[model samples]
Target: MGDLAFEPPRGGPTLWEIGIPDRSAAEFYIPDPDPNYINKLYVNHPDRFRQYGLWARYTDLYPDGDLVYTVGVSDYKTDWFFAQVTRKKDDDKYEGTTWQIKFNLETVNQTGTYKLRIALATAYVAELQVRVNNQNSNPPLFTTGLIGHDNTITRHGIHGIYRLYSIDVNGALLMEGENTIFLTQPMSSSALQGLMYDYIRLEAPPPNNSTKKI
Candidate 1:
C-alpha cells in the first residue's frame, strides 16, 4: 500500500517493504477497528517508468462493516483511505477482512522461478490462500501451520523472514511467464493483521542441455 518496489536488479534481486523511519517512534500501529477512530490507508501505483506489469488491491473490515481500497499501475492516488479491524468476542479468528495482492507478469522481461515472499508482524495459525492468476476455486498452492511463531520458538512480534515458495500446493514447479501470484489472509489471531510484503524475485534456472568444448 506504499511505494511498491519494482526496481531492476543492481547486483541480484531487489527487496521491497515499508521503509521504517529514521527514528524509533516513527513506527505506525494498525489499531482495532472502531467507528469513532478511523485509520487512513495509503494506496498508490509504482512510478510510470516501471509500472507496466504490477498491480495491487485489498479490502479491510471492522466489526461494523467493510472498506475497500484499490491501486493500479496506470491509476495512482494519494488520497484519504481509512482502515479498521477489531477483535471478536466469541471467535479466535478475526472475521470479514480479505486481502488480494497480485502481480501481472505478462509484460515483465525477467522469467524463471519467482519466489513469493510474505512477512507478518504477529499471527496465530495464519492461513495463506495462494493462487495463480484469478482462479479463486483452485486449491491453495500451500497452507501454513503456526509459522513464524510459537511452534518452534516463543516470539511475540515480527518474524525476520517471509514464508513462501514458488512451487504449487501439489509440489509442482510454477511455470514461467505471464503468471500472477495471489495471497489471501482471511483470518488471523490479531485484529486487523498487518501483511508486510517483501519482494518477489525471478531467477532463471540453468539450461537443461550443455556441451563441453575442448
Candidate 2:
C-alpha cells in the first residue's frame, strides 16, 4: 500500500509480503477469505496475457488528464499485459513474479501532484512508461527506469526506485471520473520486472460526495 522496495540484487527479488499472517500495531488486520478470491481469479493463469498478447488494457481506459496516451509493453520481447497488480498472487509461490496496473483511491483522486512507488517483485529485465488518455505525455514522467541513454539506467542497478513523473495532465493535473493505469512484465522471467507499482499517492481535492451525474 505504500512505496515498495527490495534490498538489492542477490536478495532473490523482494516482494511485499502478505500483510497479516500475524497481528501488528502498524499493519492492517485482514482475515483470510473463505475461498481466497485471488486463488480462484481468472487472470492469474500463465496464458491469460498470452490470449491477449503481451499487453492488456489496465483500467477502463478512461480520460482523466489532457493527453492521449499510446501504450505498449516490452518484456525484452514484445509488449505484454502484465497482471497481478497486487502483491497477492494466484499460486502464492512467487507472487512477486507478476506486475499489475490496478490503482487505489489515492491514485483515482489524484489532484495537485502524484507519485508512484515501485518495488521489484523479482530480478527481471524491464522498462516502464506512463500514458494518459492516449498519448505518451511529452517528456514522459517515467522511462525505462533509466535516464540519459546508452543502456545507462538511472534507477538501474537492481531494486529500481523512481519518483514524481508528471504523468498525463501535467500542469493541468488529473481529474476525477474514469482513468487508467498500466503495468507490464513477463511470466516469472529473470529481468527488470518487479511489482510495477508499490502504491500511488496524490495531493488531491477533498472527497467527492456529489450525486450529480456527469
Candidate 3:
C-alpha cells in the first residue's frame, strides 16, 4: 500500500472568530426598506435586501455618526449595518465612513504574530484601511489599496466576486485589555463606493507542536 499521511490545515490557530466564514453577509443586519421607496416584488420576500433606498437608511439610522460594533454586547443581526457606506450630509454630499469593532483581550502574546482574516462579500471601487487600537495611525496596519469594481451594492445583490485577505498583525500592536479595530473605506467619490464584509476573524500564533499524521 502507498504511504498516506495527514497534515494539519494551513494558517494559525484561531483566537477569536467574528461572524461566520461563509462568503456572504446575509447573516448580518439587513435593515427594513423605506416605505416611500419599496419594491412590490421583493416585499416580504426572502430577498428583502433587494429593496431600493436601503443604502440611504444608514443616514436615517445613525444621523450623527458611523457604526460602532461592540463584540460581546452588540447583536450582529440588529446592530451591525449590512454595508459600510458613506454618510450623507445635510448639504446633499457624501462622506466616507470609518467603522469600529471593539473587543477585549485578557492577555497578550508578545512573541507571537497574530492573523486577521477578512473576507469581503463585495466591494465597489473602495479602499479598506485597517488600524489596530489607533484610528489615526499614519500608516495603517493593513490597507487594501483601491480594490474591487463589482457594483453589487447598487444591484441589490447580496454578494459579488469573493475576496479574502489574510493580514499578519504584529504582537506589539495588541494590548492586554480592550482593543479596537478600525475599518475605513476612504473613497467618497460616490455613495456606491463601499464594501460589504463577509466575515472577520482574529487568529493566534501557531502552536509549537509538530503536525499530526494518520
Candidate 4:
C-alpha cells in the first residue's frame, strides 16, 4: 500500500460545520485567549514547541538509530509528525526503542485535574507511562494494545486519538515542576515499521479562584 498522509481539514469552515453560527461566533472563537478557566497547553505539532520562546528541551530519543527522529511538518505526507523508532538492520533487536516529550509546569505546587490527548499509530503493545521528577518506576499509566481490538480508531493519519485524564494511581498530578512523560514500545520487527506519534495535548483544570472575595 502507498504510504498515505492524511491532512486535517482547513479551519475556515470548522465552526460552521460544527454548528456554531454567525457574528457572535467571534466571541466563541477566541484565537488568543485571555487567561481564564481551563488553561490548555496543546503539544499538537513539533513546531509548536518553539512558540514558548524558551530554551526548554522538548524532544528526546534513546538508543538512537535509523528512522528514529522528528521530521519537518507537512499538511499530509512525510514530516507531519514524529516518525516511528526503527532500528537499523545491524543494530541489536533487543536494544528496544523509546521516545519522550517533556512539559515544564510553571504553575506548580497546586492541586487540580490534568488531561492528555495523544495520537499514536502502531501494531504492538505500546506502554504509555509518566514519571515525575525522573522517579517512580511504576507500571505504565495506560497500555494501548492492538488497534482495532482495543477501542482504537484511525481518526488522524494512521494514529488513533488516545485520551488520558486521571490522577495516577499514586494520586499525583505530574509533579509541581519538571515532569517527563514517556511512550515506550517494546522490541519487535513490527515496531521496526515505526510507532507514529501524531500529537499530544496536556491540559490542566482551572485554578480555584472561587474562594476569593470579589
Q: Which runs of model 1 end up more than 4 angstroms from their true locations?
A: 1-97, 106-111, 148-179, 188-214
* Top candidate (TM-score): 3
Query: Clashing residue pairs in candidate 3, if any?
Result: none
* Model 4: lowest-lDDT 10 consecutive positions: 14-23
lDDT of candidates 1 onward, in order: 0.33, 0.29, 0.84, 0.34
Clashing pairs in 4: 84-195
Give the runs in model 4 whose Cα sits over 4 Å from its true position: 1-81, 89-94, 121-132, 146-173, 190-193, 207-214
TM-score of each: 0.41, 0.31, 0.90, 0.44
Q: What local lDDT does model 1 show for residue 133?
A: 54
At residue 163, what lDDT does model 2 achieve? 26
Give the runs in model 2 whose Cα sits over 4 Å from its true position: 1-111, 146-171, 184-214
The root-mean-square deviation over C-alpha atoms between each candidate and the true structure, in angstroms, is 12.1, 15.3, 5.1, 16.1
Across 1-214, the per-residue lDDT of candidate 1 in tens digits comes to 8889775333223222222312111132222333333223412322121211111112232344333222233211221111112235454455534433333322222333333443333333445566655547556665563334322112212223444344312112333233444555565455434333223333323343131211
lDDT of 4 by residue, 1-214 (tens): 9999976322121100111112111111112222232234534442322223111111222234322222121122222233333343344343334544444554442443445445443333334444433434565565554332221211112333332223322215455444555555554443323344444445454444121211
Clashing residue pair totals per candidate (backbone < 3 A): 3, 20, 0, 1
Q: State the local distance difference test value for candidate 2.
A: 0.29
Tens digits of per-residue lDDT for model 2, 1-214: 9998865222111112222211111121111222323344424443222122111122212112111222222121122222222122334322222222322232332332333333322222444555543334454454555322221111212113332232323313443444454433323332223333222322232234222222
Q: Candidate 3, TM-score vs. the true structure?
A: 0.90
Answer with 1 or 3, whichever has the higher lDDT. 3
